[model samples]
Target: MGGFEDREKAFEAKYARDEEVAFRVTARRNRLLGQWAAAQMKLTPEETEAYAKSVVQADFEEAGDEDVVRKLVGDLTAAGIAIDESTVRVAIEEMAAEARRQFMEAK
Candidate 1:
């Protein structure tokens, strides 16, 4: 764990090959996101998983709408990926506005 990049590479390799470790890590990440979102919403950590799951699923499966963005940002505290919620929000909002404009123009 102390070897920095080497450790991270090792962990990634393990994650690629070890289902158990992957699952444990995934659950831990979810727990982290849940805790973060729960704090934002003033809820308990125990009460956060459902929300986190919903948010995570929406981000992956939905149309990338405001709800998806809101939920994603609200709960994405433990994400290893470096993304800023404000940037995501702005991008989504721009897309939504452009979609609306195009739809209206076509009518």
Candidate 2:
């Protein structure tokens, strides 16, 4: 019984670690994407990082990528980037499509 409990604890710990790693990887990917988008707006590196972090904050769990893209569009617009809704929508769709591709690839 003691060995069984120990094995269960070990399994839980491994799952926790995996979840953390997955979260970090997703976070880093979003930050990188934000930085890439910010570059197109001619923002400084620090500004880009700030922008990226903000994007990460809007994740809101399952909403995830769409929310990030939505916020990116809003932030860029607020920064006077001259982007319109149609363009932002298009970009969001494209990104979602790309993510779908990556997800399928991973499987």
For lDDT, the strongest prediction is: 2
Worst 10 residues of 2 by lDDT: 95-104
The lDDT per prediction is 0.55, 0.71
Supply the TM-score for candidate 2: 0.64
Tens digits of per-residue lDDT for model 2, 1-107: 99999999999999998887666656666666677578868889888889778766778645546677677777788778877657766755665555555655765
lDDT by residue for model 1 (1-107), tens: 46898989998888776776434444344444545555556666556767656644554454435556566564454543445778656645554455445545655
After TM-score superposition, the amount by which residue 51's alpha carbon in candidate 1 deviates from its true location, in angstroms, is 2.0
Model 1 spans with C-alpha error above 4 angstroms = 1-17, 44-46, 53-70, 74-83, 86-107
In Å, residue 84's CA in model 2 sits off its true spot by 9.8
User: Cα deviation of 26 in candidate 2 (Å)?
Assistant: 1.4
**Model 2 misplaced regions, further than 4 Å:** 61-63, 76-107
CA shift of 86, model 1, Å: 7.9
